[model samples]
Target: MTFSAFLWMTFGIFGTLAIFSFLYKDNPFYKFAEHLVVGVSAGYFVIILWHNGLTPNLFQRLADGDWYFLFLNSSKPWYLIPAILGAMMWTRFSAQYAWLSRWPMAMYIGIATGIAVPLEMANRINKQLFAMMEPIDFANFFGTQGFDLLDPTSGLSQLIVFVGAMCALIYFYFSKAHEGVFGRVATVGIYTLMIGFGASFGYTVMARISLFINRIQAIEAWRATGFDESNPEYHGGFPAVFWVILLGVVAYAIVEIYQHRNRPPQSEEPSA
Candidate 1:
């Protein structure tokens, strides 16, 4: 295959192996592989900034004598604000002017928190709220059985799930005590939440198994043939990146399990 294909093939093989190395234990090899993934991700983000911000808006403008774009917008030249803030971050390196750096840092954090709150709510509320309103059908995942939830078509499942979601949401409401309808509902919600979580955990395990199978496919197909992201020709045509993610998660899981297993057992001494 082509060099690019060869590169992906190499990544799929070793990356998969490096990830699986953690199965034995949380070794340096797995840590190296995991860190490599993170480093690559951070590097990729830098590349994106360079391509989107530097290449066009910064460097191109400087080259073309469009200083207005650098300092600010054509109308306002506000771009200078970000540049100034960026420069201010470096000030923290010194002892004296470190206080000057906090203005930008505070603004950055304040703006991020401002943006994130609304997005978090929309993600949790908008999607899940509707899900709460809708009927529950386990057969949706099975496809062929269609929407027939059960013989009785019990709304208890939906009620339980909805109550659980709502009650769990209420648990986060620190303003007041969970009383009245919320108190009763939230109690039910806790049980429903537990059941939902248990089912989800099972699903997650199955997904990991699927991922392992996919990684095997990627390695075998690409080893002889090639990895084609655009129009990959493989046994199952699975992307190598999926395997990387799966491996990373698995590695993290094993580490977590090992940590739990190795922790000193708690004493059950009688309380005074």
Candidate 2:
């Protein structure tokens, strides 16, 4: 293996093991891995935002204007408003001018909320209402079978969805007391809600399991390159790096254990 590739693999193996070490207990290795990832991601995203966001949208547009004119000659002079607001956010670092930062923050939130509310209403409320209003195809409900509730597009499935939605809505209606028929419908609503939640939780757990499997696969891939010197992919440095890290960790653990065992115990004062 090339030296560069070997170095990358070594770092990968160390990082993977370091993160996994958290399962045993919190340690310097895990902290190092976590901080390294956070620091790298922060720096990476800063550069990405500068290049993809500010450089093109703001800087490039004002590039043609003279500095003396404050970029007023630029075609999109209005962009300066947002640029100034962004700059104003830095006032948060100043003790006296910290209040200035709130203006930009408020503006950001106000604009964001104004844009978000309508979109959310359209997506979550309007679309769902439309979906429930759709006519069920009872003629082809079974789709060549006696029952096909599993098919989302089937009439039976759509009918169940409509009924469950109504029941769930009724459960949230606090005006009428839940008793008799209303209580039974509300109970059905509880079942529907639990089923939805369980399905979502199951999907999330499966996703996490898939990620763990991927990590194991990566480790296996690295190990598949046999340790034999005769193998083309084999590198002496790979095994050397692994052993060095492993021994270092083991030695540190031994030192800690020895110190803990040999150290004098502290005496407590008599209770008042």
lDDT for position 14 in model 2:
77
For model 2, the superposed segments whose C-alpha errors exceed 4 Å read 73-76, 144-146, 225-232, 266-272
- Cα lDDT tens digits for candidate 1, 1-272: 45565556666577778889889878666788899999999999999998997777755654534555453445435555776887899999999999989999999999999999999889987876777778665544333344434533345556555656777877667687779876776677677678779999999999999999999887766654544444444434344545665687688779979998999988799667
Q: Which candidate is the best by lDDT?
A: 2
TM-score of 2: 0.86
TM-score (all chains, Cα) for each model: 0.56, 0.86
For candidate 1, what is the lDDT? 0.71
CA RMSD of all predictions: 11.4, 2.7
* Alpha-carbon shift of residue 169 in model 1 (angstroms): 7.3
